[model samples]
Target: MPADQLTDLLDPARWDPLPHPPAMEYPLPVRRRDPRTLPPAPATGSAPEVLSRGADGVLLRLRHRAPRARAVALHASGWWRPQPADALDLVPAGDGWWEIVLEAPADWRTSYGFVEHDGPGDPPWWEAGLKAPGAPVHPDALCAHRHGAARGGAERSVLSLPFDGLFRAGRDDAETPAEVHELPLGPDAPRVRWWVPEEAGPAPLPLLVVTDGAEHVEQLGTPERLRRGVEAGVLPPLVAVFVDAGEHRGDVLGVPGGQARWIPEDLVPRLRAAGLTAPGGRRLALTDDPARTIITGASYGGLTALFTAARAPGTIGIAIAQSVSLWRYPRGALVGPLREAAGYAPLRLRLHAGRFEGSMAADARALADALDGSGAEVTLDLHSGGHDWAWWQPALLHDLAAELGR
Candidate 1:
């Protein structure tokens, strides 16, 4: 398509915006739910408990008294990476109470939840309880240190191991309210949210476009991270545009055709119209310079971030793709072709995936290596965690600071 036609195709007022595409399939680690029927565990209580171990370890004990559960397993961040293990399995005790004691690093701060399997041929139940088809399950509500809802519809229990001054521990130091706007991408297109630093100067700010806007804000605490980074002098002032995934997130983020074009061509203009980049506005300067703009996301959104940068070369300077879906099983696979492509735009990139992400981690490394061969300044980090928010939150802060910090 001609560049002019591509730009016209994304004119939200003239277009209904493309419908979200189908979901991509990737190999997520199979969780191990022991099929043995064990006696009920002792009834300790309903609330979560944490105790300090010797200097570096923290003991985490959880109790659940589900009578029909054959085995109760705990799912925390970084626990189920690489392969399935019985370490998180709660030991059966007493008549109905089941418990699992985990000795974790003292610096751990992540969310968790329980899965109760009813033996073979039965599905497991999450802490969100039972719900009708298509209903949302709030995972944060189930946690002992519940903050708010998380991404992907469900929530998890939070665990902040005893640590002082850890980067991602506890609540955000401050909060900034965001302005929400509906773009004309499609009738069903999700609304995007805009956020500026609470205390920015008159200078024009760089633009940071985040895919999966709602999840990043409500679940992963993106605004708070931005706030903390700015307050700590780790990041420059930037205007953030958060795009929502809606029900068709899989289609929207998984495919590059629609979302890739819509963001820079369509949504960005809308931002400008809102006086975000106007001379006397919030001063979000839209530019063709790659260093002044960043696009970021996780999982399928991560894949979209890379696709967006690749598709809109001069438009997006930095791409932060966290836990990108690089596998082939899903609809949008980029590594193979990206490796073979002769030329690419001069885009600085940061790629992150959990070390426990199994094949996905390998894919991230492969993509980074290919980018390196292509002479792209790419930073690939395989952190010590799973494809969970526990890892993505910290990765976002680190990437933003590394890419745009002054």
Candidate 2:
């Protein structure tokens, strides 16, 4: 193609200004339509070998077939929204490949794509091969790894808690279940919130006490999916308690993650109080059925789930960690700790991450591998997306169905 025509192809208005590719390209159809509290993210890395990131840019080594394009210049649009700017680094070497890095400001989010160029602009301008199907066509939602397909065919939801402050725990009374009554904690109480499933038919519904309760509703689509899946038969009815993590999510969800107070005293007693009173009662208390119990969350919520599972063996049988914020904490590498934890106690886990969202996929894969090798039932889902609700929701729904539903 002539340079002029190629330039025409490279025109900003030439392509659809949507966040992602079209419907045919939409990998997770259900996710594309919902309104989430958390918006899309900016660019991370591209290429391989370097390392993708949850941070602004992702780094990778590219081995594209073209040798001349090795000296490729990079240009992007839709990242953070409304304009075009520099977003990638392409440095080629003798190995017939180049090292490419893609970046955007942390809060700058929206749809974006890259074009390959020669000098400042190339002769045969071509796509950088980084968009996905079913991605929004508007710049409002452009982001890398929007649907990295970290986990596919599963459904997910994101609920936003419009408030932030000291979290309060509340429960319902039998006479008047309408009111959400506040509960009490000891001297130094850990914030807690109680969950009453829409329909509770079985005894000892498995329990999952998630840290950063408010954030789960804010960042991840947990409540909606949990309710819908139970109603739709996709997942079994399980009791979930989102413990109020408040501002200390960093400290609480990390080393101790607030398990001492949250689990041993607060959680168990509450479930016992809510006791199995229906018909011929079974001894299956909410906190009793370990195998049926699963602790889940994303990011810090994710790390907390893993930490809780690691510390409390036979108590929390399942761990659902999505885009785990492992590097944030001391000894943040969760795999080694999990490996040791698994030795003392057995656990089943569903770990997943994508290439574009930091080193999530790689790190989680290593952890899953280690646990699986140690005789734990582990499923490793490496998707084509990043660290966003777009991928997390579907990944958890599908992977959990395989690991826990059956």
Per-residue CA lDDT of model 2 for 1-406, tens digit only, reads 2323322322323222223212121121110111122232223433222333455443222323235543432222111111122223345534444334333333222212233444554323223223321122211111212212122312222111111111101111111221111335664766655444556665567666566565444334355556556667766666666676565555555444355225633565566566533334433356466666677777766766776665564566788777776555432355554565566556787776654565567678666665667656677666544455544555565555555565
Once fitted onto the true fold, the runs of candidate 1 whose alpha carbons sit more than 4 angstroms away are 1-71, 77-86, 92-98, 103-110, 116-152, 160-190, 269-288, 329-345
Best by lDDT: 1
**Per-candidate RMSD, Å:** 7.4, 19.8
Q: Which stretches in model 2 have alpha-carbon errors above 4 Å?
A: 1-187, 218-221, 257-261, 264-287, 329-336
Give lDDT tens digits, candidate 1, residues 1-406: 3344433333334422244344322223432233233333234333455643677565555666667777666665555421333445567765766776556555555556666676574333232222211122223322444433344456565565533222362244244444343335567556777777757766656788988887766665667667767878888777888888777766677565557668876776565555453224545544445677888888888877876766665567678888887662343245433332214346677888875555677878877875667645678877655566666766676777777853
What is the lDDT of every predicted structure here? 0.60, 0.46
Q: How many residue pairs clash in each candidate?
A: 11, 31
What is the TM-score (0 to 1) of candidate 2? Answer: 0.52
